[model samples]
Target: MASLSSLLPAPTQQVWDRDDERKAKRVGSALVVSQTSVPPYGQRKGWVPRAEEDFGDGGAFPEIHVAQYPLGMGARGKESTSNALAIIYSKLTDLLPSEVLAEDDPTLQKPDDEDIQDITEKTKLALEKLTNAKISAAMPVKAAPKAVS
Candidate 1:
């Protein structure tokens, strides 16, 4: 059996401390985004609606209802609050070594039949398990208020 170290490639890169610091500074400045959202009720600049609280509204929360690609929060801080951590979890697992990555966690598992039906079924099942309801049934169905005569 081959030892794990033998399978790995030796690092060939040199550390450039100064260059790394400069790159960090440049990237930090470039990606400097204000991650905090507005409080549910208040007035301030760049204050969008309090997304954290509003997402919990009983009237079918959009974040909970819709299936977003990359699932979790769009930005960094939002991940924990979004209830979309599964997406991030999946991504992280994908970056792990094959030996450890072969676990049976549904999130880390791949599906067979790379077709629309299979994808749809898997997505529906995942959403059902997560939300504890049939995906379609979980959605708010509109019944036109008897045409206000």
Candidate 2:
């Protein structure tokens, strides 16, 4: 019988220093983001009100998944977030009637679709400025200082 480690596609690359100061600072930053982005997402910055109602808004659900990781904070934060989200998606998939999951907990699926040629951005910075993305922001311009002659 093969060991559990053998099941993973590849061992996680240890590109980060576990005791780095930046990592600790970023963890705090992540927690701050999580506190805002979860539960009441209505008041988040730039969050536009939608016509349709959202799920779990009644506070019926006890808890929801939020990013708070001891490892993989700043530099690789997106990767960690993506990985955690994928796992949650897998569980949701498993619950669906039509979906077929090989492994219940972590179903290994291709991050990219085989048929499409879409490029997946691993980092948030690249995604923030993706070619087809449209974003706009403008601060109020103070009226040109009153001209006194």
| Pairs clashing within candidate 1 | none
The lDDT of each candidate is: 0.55, 0.45
On a 0 to 1 TM-score scale, where does candidate 1 land against the true structure?
Answer: 0.14
lDDT of 1 by residue, 22-108 (tens): 988887795666565434433443433334443343232333334332433454555355454554545866778666564778876
- Model 1 residue 144 distance off true place after TM-score fit, in angstroms: 74
User: Cα miss at 93, model 1 (Å)?
Assistant: 32
Total backbone clashes of model 1? 0
Error of 1 at 45 (Å): 17
In angstroms, give how far residue 28 of model 1 lies from its true place: 7.2
Q: Count the backbone clashes (under 3 Å) in each candidate.
A: 0, 0
